[model samples]
Structure formats: structure tokens, C-alpha cells
Target: MQKRSVILAYILWLFLGQLGIHRFYTGRTGSGIIQLILGAAGWATTGILIGWFPLFVLWIWLVIDIFLIPGMCRNPE
Candidate 1:
């Protein structure tokens, strides 16, 4: 596998995280899919009252995820 830049990954995660493109770029397909689903859920459910909390959690999760990508990509399989 080719080496991926952590900085680029972080930028993508911070900006287009909801699309899971960052995750895919980092070779984390499972997580990318999960993020995509959760993000979609958050987006679709927003403004429905009950969805507010989940959306907040998802946003926070995305932020944390951005920080974690470097460590995850550095790990040896």
C-alpha cells in the first residue's frame, strides 16, 4: 500500500468527513461506511427534535475521528 499523508487525511476529515471520503482514503472502509451512515442519519434527522442529540454526538465523533486517523493509519496490520 502507498503511504498516505496524515495532514491531508486530517484536512479531509475535518472538511468532508460526512462523506466518508477521508476514511476511504486512509484505507478504513468499515469506519468510512459507518461514518457515512451516521452522518447521513444525522443530516436526514436534523430539525426533527429527537435527532438533535444524535447529530451533536455525530459531529463530536467526526472531530475525534479526524484526530484518530493518523494513529490508525500508522498501525501495522
Candidate 2:
């Protein structure tokens, strides 16, 4: 397997994580798509009164990802 760069992954996570870019970069396509959908939903509904909820969840998810990145960078068996 190819080596993954934690720095680059974190960079993606920092800049484009709302769109699930970091997850995609780390070879996690499924969760990436889910994040993407959630992000889009968050953005799409932001104008509504209840829209902030998805964004809030997304924030928590991203913060949790900060801890998961090292494990994500590990090579697959």
C-alpha cells in the first residue's frame, strides 16, 4: 500500500473537511460521501431556523476527526 501523509490529510481536513475532502484523501470514500451529504445539507438549510443543527453536528464530527487522523493515516492491512 502507498504511504499516506498525515500533514496533507490534516491540511485537507482543516481546509476542506466540511466537504469531506480529508476523508476522501485518506481513502475513506463511504464516510466521505456521508460527510459530503451532511455538509451540503448543512449549507443548504442554513437559511432556515433549524439549519444550524447539521452544521453543529458537522463541527463535532470534524473535531472528533482530529483524534482519528493518525489512525486513518495507517496503512491498510
What TM-score goes with each of the models?
0.77, 0.91
Give me the candidate number with maximum lDDT. 2
> Backbone clash tally for model 2?
0
lDDT of 2 by residue, 1-77 (tens): 77688999999999999999988888899889989988899899888856688889889999999999888888532
Of candidate 2, the 10-residue stretch with the lowest lDDT total is 68-77
Tell me the deviation in Å of residue 44 in model 2.
0.9
lDDT of 1 by residue, 1-77 (tens): 66788888888887888878788888888877877887788788776866677667777878798668877667512
